[model samples]
Target: MTVALLETAWLVPLYPLLAALLSLAWSPGLISRTGPRPCGYLNLLMVSAAFVHSVVALTALHTNARAGAEALYRPITFGWTWLDTAGLRIGFDGLITEPALVAMTVITGLHVLVQLYSIAYLEMDWGWPRFFGSLSFFEAGLCALVLTDSLFFSYVILELLTFGTYLIVGTWYNQPLVVKGARDAFLTKRIGDLILLAGVIALLPLTGTWNFHGLQGWAADQINNHNTLPPAITLILLALIAGPMGKCAQIPLHLWLDEAMESPLPSTVLRNSVVVVGGAWVLLRLEPLIELSPLVQTVLVIVGGTSALVGSLIALAQIDVKRALSFLVSSWLGLLFVAVGLGGIDVADHLMLVYPLAMALMLMAVGAIVLTNITQDLTQLGGLWSKRPLMGLAFLTGAAGLMALPPFGGFAALRELLELTAASSSPAVLGGVVLITNALISAGLIRVFGLIWAGRPSVFTTRSPEVLWLMALPTFVLMGLMLHLPQLLVINGVFSLSPLPGWGPQALPLLLSTLVGGGLSAVFYLRPHPLAHLPAALGGLQDWLAHDMQTERFYHRTVVWLVVSLARLSAWSDDRLIDGFSGASGSAAMAGARRLSLTTSGRSQLYALTLVLGVVLMAIWLLATPAAAPELVRPFS
Candidate 1:
């Protein structure tokens, strides 16, 4: 029975793909008679099916483990040959195993909940077919990416996701901002994809396979044999890191995610919750290679730490509702990167598993509020607590789930990371950074909540109402999940909860820091006239944080300038050298043709005289040469 259930794992992604195709039936030309609402319903059903099947597969794996089956601990790969030529072979392989199945279950489950939330969130609109279809397409791509064991296919699936993001973000293409946002998002991720391709190409020749497990085995062999990679391979590993940095919205490539806020809120829910995780997911898979390079590892830690610090700072200054939450996504992913850099995969995995539920709930709660107010500006929203208490509670629950609060996944995952960091040199310093970053993350969430919910109601939110049941149900449902995640983690044996007596050493400092940050934000922003404005001396600093520390401007001066300069140089060279040489050669040929044309005549007498002169010249040349042949032989032959 377990074997049969595991065999059905391939249907996970297929369900969503089929749903996407079915959604096309609602396109304008195909089924004009029917309303588009069913399109969303169909997608919800499909995602539900996918999630259920995933649960079954996960249950089978667990059962097999209980039964002591050999395959329980190993990846059960199902694949077919895809390519074979000239000593090269590749396969489309999916791994139905422990963590992969677990990840799939979570991904599909959130997809189902998000789709349900979107049903009412977008009910007044008429873009259901395109919206729901894109959601399913994204789900299928993400599911396939998690399940695929082959690195080569992982790249392919990620590219599909990039396109899916473009399509989904650009769904409102009638708006200019949406178009630009989609274009920027696509290009940003494409840059990382290209660099990752370079790394894959370089590694394939050396490793002879593109499977993640195969790569792991090869890495282990190298380590066991005391082999070291050359500098070039180390650079390749760095190139590989570039992909995740961009995908995960790390610095220098994070502008796209901010711009992508022009998209619908439902898309933001997934992008913030799970889509960005895709990048870190790939990075986690490549951990074996990443562990081999000290320089690359240090870079990861530096980038992650910097993003966490800066992202939290920027989130604090943002008045735009989605931008605040969006920046936090970067901050959270940054911590995950740090965990991976510190060789804490279990911590990273725990963080990823718990991240999507809480974040999605928060975003959905925000979406619920935005639906009524029709604005994402926190400065223009307040006192919603009286009307939309569930949303307020959901947001608070999400904040608790994300911060180092008790009984939530964030507290557990972060405490583990803190414990791990304690063993490093300057443990005090590294641990301080972790505590400070978490404190700031907590502060940022509180700041947003205070600005939007706790103070006097702004004109924009004065008439705010509870979101429809469809939206509220999903928000509360996910809120429940966030609350119980730590319990789930404990039950699954992925993490063990320390009894209350054992909590002081690890959990106290984090809890205290969170309270400090949360209390400060609440005190400052939760009043009718709260210290809403900065002092004159700090105005410049406030502006910098509000504008993402002018990162885009810096890019314009540096990377953009370099690219523009190279393009201008290429155009100038083409015009001056390539075009000039070709033009001169053509002119010379034309002038010669003109001169040759002048020698021709239209008179028969002139033609006869020319022929007679030619024959005379030949006779004179023959006579001048003493060894000339006979006239007939020379002239006729």
Candidate 2:
């Protein structure tokens, strides 16, 4: 029974994809009387099916694992040849692994909650078909991305997710910001996707296979020989990092998530939680190859550290509620990159495992607030603790789950990261950075909590009522999951109890950092404090970080400006040089044809005279150059 279900794991992605396609019928009002809700219900059922399938398969794998270690790591692959030629072959081969199954369960489960949350959140909205379809579209792509064994196919799936983001983000097409946000999201991720494609294509010629296992074996060979990747291949690995860098919302490419906030809150839940990790998923798969290059590893550390530290700082300064979480996503995933860079695959796996749960719960909790209050601006929200204590607790639970506080999901992940960094090449620099990033993250999450549920009631919260059960239910359920996630992980054997004791050498500092960060934030925004809003002198610095450190403006001046300039040049060339040359040649042909037509009198004498003149010119040219005449007549002779 377990084998049968595991063999059919490939059908999981198709369920949602079929739902997305079915949405087309109602989305375009083919059945106008039923409204779009039927389509939505169908999508919900489909995602639920996916969720169940993944859970059962995962459960079966775990149960069967008692047989031996082989049952745990053995891949159940399902795929077919997509392209085949003498020297090149591309396969649609997908494999089910323990990690892939786990990812599917998280992805589909979140989709279920998000879809349920959206029912009430978008109840009045008529774009349900488009919205729900796109949501399923994201789940389908993410599922396939995890299941696929080919790196080339992973790139394809990531591109599909990018497109789905644009579609979902633009669901409210009437809004200018929505359209702009969709465009920015697509274009920014495209930059990474294109570079990743280059790396994917380039890798095949060198390694001769795109299969993850094959690449792993090849990387192991290089590791065995103690050989560094050649400089050119090193560039390929670096290029490969760009895809995840953009997907995970790392710095520079990070602004897309902020812009994508124009999307609905429910979709924001997925983007903030799992969708962005699709790139990180690929990066984790490519860890073996990345390990073969020390330079690439160092680059990962620099980029990840900068994103981790700067993203947390930026999150602290963000007044827009969703933007605050968006930056934190980058910060957390940055730690994932840091882990992979330092060769802490197990630690990275742990970080990736817990991130989506806490993030989803927090977003679901915030989604309730945003839906009721009709605002997402931090300053405009306050004093919801009394009205929405459950949600407040939900938010707090999520915050704890996200931070490195003891007895939660994030503590283990962060402690493991801290432990990994301690023995790294530069322990102080690496470990201090992770510790500080955790502090800043704790501070940022609490700061948002203080602004929303702790301070005196702002105008937005004065009469804010509780949200519908649909929204509240998912938040509460996820909150419960977040609270119990550590035990769940332990039962599932993600990590043993040894690394998860109440106190350890690394756990203490992580706990202290969380305290210091959360304590200061609570004192400032939760109660009266002189420095809560900052002094006037630091106001400029505050504003700078709030605006994402002028990251967008910088891109507009550089990359955007260059792209616009090149586009204008291409347009001008098409009109001026290309079109102008064609126009000139066309006009000359018309003029010469007109002259020749006028001379084409029906008079036989004139025709004969013209023929004689043509012959005389040919003879004159032949006489002028005898050598030319012989060469010209050679073919005929």
Candidate 3:
């Protein structure tokens, strides 16, 4: 393709955004008059077009790369300057072509499949237009996020997606939990976006640019020239990390995601599969800036490692299937954070590449299960394996990928993390921790699966309907993709187990950890004992785990409560203090004028007497003072 044609890659995301706008702007009356199917078909067409454009862009990028065309890798800039201010500038720059092309292709491609799947999943629902419209909007936002090079623009897009999440999660507005969940998700993510904005704003003054490429170059130049950035840089990094932490649902920011499971399965698919990865992607994009400060990197490592450990432990105790998987998502992302903190970009990149596939598979399987059983709680259902063999198989395959088993994408990524941890300072301790977390994750996955598919039919299961092929088809596709992802990675140079020391040593501990974790999970959950008390043994910790450590409550009481109180105080002051003072001052002035009027009753004579008295006093003073008569003497001369 010619350069101009190649640049059409930007249109990939733009098309969906436009379609979303059109769908949203189209009145509900018009949609109702026409029908929801037309709108759905229109959305499908737009997404399909975007997907085709992404594929073409990827093909062009690959061909150009093979031809040694480095210029093809550069970001495709477009549009007017996004923002400009005192000594700082930002623009609408993004990688319309290159690696973003690949990311867009994967994200939109999966969205298309998910949307197709949702047709059947939500067939009985009347909110088709709203659901599909929001899905398109999410695709557009995510695509723009991947393409954008400016941190400021990235933050804006992140906020936009946060809004989209709110809408999608609250699609079922009649459900109180759905409303609460959507609000919590939006509020939590907004907190992170605000922090990230602070970082982006601080960065603009420090570097005078917001473009990722420019910032990376500037940061590298500073390091090369032995320049020291101010302490504000670390604060900026921390602020930026807040966005990722919320997006990736790490630690304290994780509660929103668990609650968000009350949303439809399609939204869950998008959130878990690709939307969360937006945070990790931004983190990777700013890796150079982050590596500038050791303090920042240390914080990342600690938060990531701690989140991974704690999230996985919680995952082991979760009773809600989606909640458990949500914890797994957080835990896995924490591992990615560790990779990034340790300066393992390649490993981080590999993990990013693989995580979405694993997540997509898991979500697809979960979507299928939830569709059939009408519940996401594992404790409410069982014996689905015989009824829906395809879904069960898909779930098992996805679980394998999540467990980091051989020939799965998670395996390659986890291997890299283990190797890196083993070669780090606290190899023994870190390795042990990572190993234990993996084991817990394995147990968590198997526990969910067993509770969903293995035992005798429960009341919920007995009432459950058979899953349609629309859902099963997507699940199977994802399962097949998971099975073949290792080979794909190998071809892409992500699965090369090279014995480089800096890449870390793959010794017995690493191998043994995987084996032990997998084996224990298989024994405990897959092949359960008749007298097993494992499920009953967990109890409240399970509740806490299901609730995602009460992060929402903490944020509500601390951050949300504080903000609301301060706002109320401000409103009170505005209404009662400042306005009241102004009103009181006006009233006092009126009262004083009224008193003066009372004192000046029959005012004409009083005014004349006072004027005569004042004039007489002036005349007496002038006659007594020599200087007072000077003007009269001068006039006579």
Candidate 4:
């Protein structure tokens, strides 16, 4: 009960948020006086401070836990009640816990690296202040998201982050595609958030609390009492899943991430690396509630497995480097979903821990490439190894980690996943799906590397110089970090080889999958082929893959069209029904005013006469109302 304000972890998220607000306030005049460079440096400073604070909090948590501190610490109070009712009360408060601290560490650390990378990646852009400001805002939201305990508050923060995505992606509003991309991202996430809100409302009556711990307790009690049913729990789970689907960019809600590549590379790095994982985080956070329903778990595994397979296929056909990475983001998230569905929270948690690092490395490399060549399309670039060997090396290392090659973090996570599936009922089907998906992801990454570093030098790439060290430094650091993450996992008990039946499986399949995928990529995109044309059998599948399984088109035709039509109908109703009623009332009032005006002209005597007449009429009416009064009295009686 120290109640030490400074020691509390809430400050970690608040610092960057305050900085973002300050930067946004000063943004208009910032460039006019001090310019974008200073703003970029300011952003770096803000994120650095948050990162330091996060580290401090993490250290404190570890120390306390090692000392066997009580499970429930003193709640950090912010203000008065947020809402109060006859039998329930919700408060605006915050608290720090182990999970929150861990998530904060990951988010803040990634932000630091990404912001540092952005310094060189966006150096020449005029909208630097806007870019850094939005990024800081996003960091603030994500940090707050991790710290909050209330599901209601978590959803609020998620919505705020969705808005941040809109602004960050459309920072260059003059560009038409960027504008559309931003709009699409916002609208799609909004739909999912609205659905989640419905779920939240439904749960309030049942649990009588919005706090994560409280809700979990209630759910557990309900399950123990044998009162929970599939239908009711499935409804709640579906509602909760909506937000993650939108945030994670899973199928039916994933096209935004692909289109979002139009944004700056720094933003893309953030989205792919950490922001998109927010959904998976939510799923993990609510694992107990979801586990109460078998139907929910089954649905998660099916969606996740299908998304992984489809996402990998699409990644293979993507021409844009960022789009390919975006697809991979979805695929990895889907894998996390599968882990959660199979009741493998530990495995999912480990995957979440390692994914951001790998994604950050890959995005940093892509950022460097795009900056140097001024393009993201793999079809338009080549021969960068000689110009920027460090970048090529970083890309390869990142690719290795992404494809789950041995001695990397992804390999450890995938092994855990394989083991988890092996113990499950549908082991063969699930295992095969994961294997093939991993293979396709490997091929996708290798294909990108070949297009960039192996083929003939493009005109744009030939003239570009090697990237500056500011960018390369962060990229290489992340690459090195990824290389050592598997060791960290072992040390941290994220995974261990033990007497557990599925543990310590042979590594041959992992190695062979990586080699075969890599070799296939080299053969197709790197090695020279006499005919340069793929077989006709794959033509249809290739086209389907290239189009992202027609997800975007489906959304456009169905969701987008429906939304547009609803908007139009709403507009028409507002104008015709609501406004028209108001308009008619106004017209009637005006007509009455005009009619009265006609009688008011130059008429003091007439006014007196009318007033006298009105008084006489009132008296007559009062006298005549006795009969009506008697009738009213009879009715009441």
Candidate 5:
């Protein structure tokens, strides 16, 4: 029965898919009498089933592993012909492996939790069908993404996810900010999606297959054989990373995640947790190909390092609590990129596994606070610890799970990453990058906690109460999962049990970094600080970081401006060059035709008489001129 579930794993996505499609009926009032609640409930049920299905499949796979059944544990590939033509065939392929099942479990499980929470969160919302449907759609896309074996199909799934993001973020279409957020996010992500598609299309021709296993083999053969990669192939490999760069919210394409917070918090929970990791998921798969080029790996390190440091810094400056968290999501994913760059896929895997649960837990706790107090601005919130101790504890758990605190999943993951970077080419320089980024991340997390729950009550926090039970339930459940995650890591042998809990060769430095950063932030925000920096001292710097280091402005003056200018130029050229040339040619032709038509008098008799007279005149001229009519003139002489 367990093996059968694995065989039918593809059906998991379809459940939520069908729910999303059926939800359309609600929007059109086909089910108005029952209200939009049914659509939400239906999607919730579908997601829950997918979660259970994934759990069972995962358990079965592990059961097989423990039983020493190699065949059952081996990746089982199943696919149907999607497109088959002359020398062209695309298959809807799926691979059921332990990792894929684990990802499915996380994705669907998060969806179920978010759906349950959304019920009370968006209780009075009229756009329930659209909201719930987009959520279901996201689950379906992510589930299929992890399951699919083909890079081409993964790109397809990512495109679907990009569209789903736009829909979900624009759930409150009535709000102008939401509309702008949706549009920016869609366009920004599309830039990466389009480039990644180019890489995907270009890849099949060079490597001869889109399957992950095939690509892995091909890349390994090329590298082991010591073959030099063509410059174009290297470019293609770099292009492949672009999608993940955008999806993971790294560097220049990073701001989309911040703005996407215009959506409701329930969707924000999933977006921050599972959805942002979507790109990293694809990047991990492409690590083998990326490993082939030193230049590409260097590019990854630079981008990853820059984003890690900068994103954390920006998070520290953000007053909007959601934006702060979103930027940190970018920061954490940057570490994953660095791992992939350094050829530390195992460490990257550990980071990927822990990030979603921790981020989700934090978002849910914050969501509860934001829902109750009615503000996402840090300046407008304070002293919530007394009012909502359960949530405060939950928030602390989430923060601990995220930071390099002892015994949490995050400590194990970072320790592994630190070891990897320390063994790299520039150990001191690169390892320092990892340490500094973690410190900033640690500082940022505690800074958030201090602002919201540690200080004196603000107007917004004075009357704040505990959120509804539905929201509280998921927050605590995730908190429990976060605590159990370290043990699970040991059980699965991703990390062996440390001699002291979460302690190792790298533990001291990582823990020290966490403490120094968090301790300093605690002093500034948590301890009734008259020790804070003066506004004049931090004036320009604070504004710059708070405004995302003025990235949007920089983009406006650069990328956005270039795009808008080119668009205007294209429109002008169409009107002036293309249209003018065609119009001038048409006018010239018409004028020539008009003059020719005027020369014809429209009288057949006059035309005939003129022709005869012209011929007679020609004859007379020939007769009068001796050279013209030599034979006729000889008789006259």
Candidate 6:
């Protein structure tokens, strides 16, 4: 029975996709009488079905493993060939087993929560069909991405997600910022997609397969045979890493996520939680291949570490509430990247597992506040804890889950990451990076919490009421999940013991950092104080970090300028060279035709007179020039 379910796991993604298609029936004119609310419910039903199947499959896999049916625990892969030509083959192969199913369960579960959350969040909006359809499509794409075992197809699904983000982000097409955000998101991700495609094409000939399992085996064999990838192929590996780097919103490619906040909050919830991590999921699969090149590994560490550190700093400077949360997403994922670079796969997986719930809860809490107040500026919100106790509790729970405090999901995962980093040669430095990142994250979250829920009442929060039951229910549900994550981990043996007893020299730095960060934030902003402004001397620097370290401006002067310049050059060449040549030829043809038209009279007498005059002129020229006449006669002879 377990085998049968595993074999049919492909149906999981298809379920949501079918729901997406069904949503079209609710489009404006197709079913105008039924209204758009029903579309949301339809999509919800589809996601719930997928969630149910995912749960069944996960339970079956776990049961088989516990029963010692090790053979049944093996990855059950089956799919038809998708493409075949010239001795190359790509297929839709899937691995239905533990980690993949586990990812699917999280993704589908989040989809269910997000759909319910959106129903209430968007209750007043008239764009339900497009909104819900995009959600279903995103769910399907992410689910397929997790279940598929092929690197080639992973890129394909990622591209789909990129397009889906464009659609979802631009849902309110009337808004200029929304359109711009959507365009930026699409173009930025496209750059990564193209680079990844190049890497995939280059990789297939070398590895001779695209399947993750096959590639892993081949990579292992190459290492065992003492055959290392050459310099050129190592560069290809670097190119491959860029795809995930951009997808995961690492430095340089990280600007898209910030701009994407112009999207609806529900979409932001999923993007922040799972969609952004899709790149990292692919990276985890390609970890073996990336580890082959030390240069690539170092690159990953540098990118991840730098992004983590800088992203946290930038988060502190952000006044826009969503951007604060957005930067933290990059920061945490940055830690995951560092783990992968340090060859800590288990730690990275642990990070991914613990991240979504907490992040979703926080974002949902933020959304609830924003909905009630119609504002996201931290400075404009305060003293809502009394009226909206549930949101405050939800936010605090999320904040705890995210920070390195005791008994929370983040603490264990971060402690384990700290342990992993401690074993490295530069433990002090790498471990400090983790500690500092945690501290800054703690400070950032606390700062927001104080500004929004602590101080005296501001205009925005003066009369704030709790959000609708739809939104609040999901927030509480996910909050419960975040709160229970550590317990669940312990029960499953994922965490061996209580977190406090595991504290040692390795955990000391993380603990101190979180405490210091949290303490500083509480002291400065926890009361009715000025809205936490940077000092006068730090004006320039504060603005820099607040503006995403001016990364967008830097790109404008460099990448954006270069691309725009090249585009202008191309346009100029087409206008001057190609268009000029065509225009000149056209002008000359028209001139000759006009001159010919002057000779063509509508009367036969005019034609005869012109011919007679031409003959008489020729006769006169022949008589005057006998030498020219001889040349003309020679041709005739």
TM-score of each: 0.94, 0.94, 0.90, 0.87, 0.94, 0.92
Clash pairs detected, candidate 5: none
How are the candidates ranked when ordered by lDDT, highest leading? 2, 5, 6, 1, 4, 3
Report the poorest 10 consecutive residues by lDDT, candidate 1. Answer: 496-505
Q: What's the TM for model 3?
A: 0.90
Candidate 1 residue runs with Cα over 4 Å from true position: 1-3, 64-71, 500-504, 528-530, 608-637
With candidate 2 superimposed using the best TM-score fit, by how many Å does residue 417's alpha carbon deviate from the native? Answer: 1.0
lDDT of 6 at 40: 89
Which segments of model 5 are wrong by more than 4 Å?
64-73, 592-602, 610-637
Comparing 3 with 5 on TM-score, the higher-scoring candidate is 5
Give the Å error, residue 285, model 6.
Answer: 0.3
Model 3 CA deviation exceeding 4 Å by range:
1-5, 25-27, 64-68, 71-79, 84-88, 497-508, 527-540, 564-580, 596-637
Top candidate on lDDT is: 2
**Candidate 3 residues 1-637, lDDT tens each?**
5444566667777788877877864436564667676777788899998888777667666666542264364455665585569754567787664567768988988988888888888888777778888999999999988888878888888888888888899999998888988887887777778888888888877887888888899989989999978878899889988999999988777777877787888878888989999999999999999889988888888889888898887777677777788888888899899989888898898788877877777778777777777787877878777776777777778777766566666666777788888777788776776777777777777777787887778787876666787777777777788787776767766566444212234544554666776666656655456433446666655577556577667777988799999999999999999999999999999999998888776779988998999999999999998773545445554
Give candidate 6 regions above 4 Å deviation.
1-3, 65-73, 498-505, 529-531, 593-637
Estimate every model's Cα lDDT from 0 to 1.
0.85, 0.89, 0.79, 0.80, 0.88, 0.88
Q: Please give the distance, in angstroms, between residue 634's alpha carbon in candidate 3 and its true position after superposition.
A: 23
Q: 265-357 in candidate 4: lDDT tens per residue?
A: 888888888899887877788898988888889888998998888898888877888888889888988899899999999989878887888
Please provide, for model 6 over 38-69, each residue's C-alpha lDDT reduced to its tens digit, 9 standing for 90 to 100: 88898999999999888887777767654225
Clashes of 6: 0
Question: Compared with the true structure, what per-residue lDDT tens digits does model 2 show for residues 1-637?
Answer: 7667876889999999999999999887897999889999999999999999989888887677542244355567678988889978899888877888889999999999989999999999999899999999999999999999999899988988998999999999998988999999888888888888899888988898999999999999887888766678998998999999999988767888888999998999999899988988899999999988888999999989999999999999988999899899999999999999999988888899889989988888888898899999998999888888998898898889889987787888898899999989899999999989999999999999999998789888999888889888888888888878888887877656765633355888889999999898888989747897779999999999988899889999999899999999999999999999999999999999999898777999988998999999999988898473444445664
Residue-by-residue lDDT tens digits, candidate 1, 317-346: 999989999998988888888888888888
C-alpha root-mean-square deviation, each candidate:
4.4, 3.5, 4.2, 4.9, 4.8, 4.7
Q: Which pairs in model 2 have colliding backbones?
A: none
lDDT of 4 at 139: 90
